[model samples]
Target: MELPKVGSIGEYIRQQRQQAKISLRQLAAQAGVSNPYLSQVERGLRKPSAEILNQIAKGLHISAQALYVQAGLIEDREPDSDVLAAIRADVTITERQRQVLIDIYESFRKENRAGNPEAQPTQPAEPPPDAAVHRENTATPDSKEG
Candidate 1:
């Protein structure tokens, strides 16, 4: 059977643990894995198999399916509305700014959902530097003599 590439699974495990606010030693004891081993796994230097992943999932109190998707062991559905809303609501911005930003975001989202790139706004170009632009410039290879 196929296994997820080690690095992705490790990264995902680490992210989930951090988000859950679990300490490495605590989680290691809970998952029945050595702290050093779990640390290596979290750093993407080791790939634990399904049984171990299931243990970790149980310790985290989350579905193994979620970890599987993170590990790239399984395809996942798009996040549901509640999950998406929760994420959107977690922003540090004030509610009024969030609403305004959400309105702009939703407008583009509608265009994307409709498959209409032409409906997108054109971004403004950056301004050119004034005459004060100097070249204390770390000279690039392209600027040097052949």
Candidate 2:
């Protein structure tokens, strides 16, 4: 079969989507665009605005610059390094706190293994051996002859 050309931004969206092996309906759902509009765009009958292009780019898991390049808006540029750096910086968690959280999570997992429902009411702790209950008869004790 002859391959379709990647001619415009819309065509690029369709091409990338096909390359990713995602159905047009799935892409439309992910991009929050209607199926008919996506089809029209893919056929080059409609051109989406930059904001919509960004949505398409996000749905395709690609940078907007790549889409712009494919649309003949500008030459291709490398992905933004600052975006990654900012993400790494935003995850400012300390190792100690992370380990503590992991330990607490594992403890809860153990409770789950012991058949505890997540929101069930808990029972009180068992009493100590010395604190065990005992029963006594009300009648007087029998006396034995020595």
Off by over 4 Å in 2: 1-7, 77-146
TM-scores for all candidates: the values are: 0.49, 0.45
TM-score computed on alpha carbons, candidate 2: 0.45
lDDT of 1 by residue, 29-51 (tens): 99999999999888877777788
lDDT of each: 0.71, 0.66
Q: Write the per-residue lDDT of candidate 2 for residues 1-146, one digit (tens) a residue.
A: 64454456676677678766788899889889999988888988777777778888778776676566556676533235453323322324432343455457557756877888873446888878899667885555565434
Q: Which portions of model 1 show Cα errors greater than 4 Å? A: 1-5, 77-146
TM-score of 1: 0.49
What is the lDDT for 26 in model 1?
87
Worst 10 residues of 1 by lDDT: 87-96
Best by TM-score: 1
lDDT of 2: 0.66
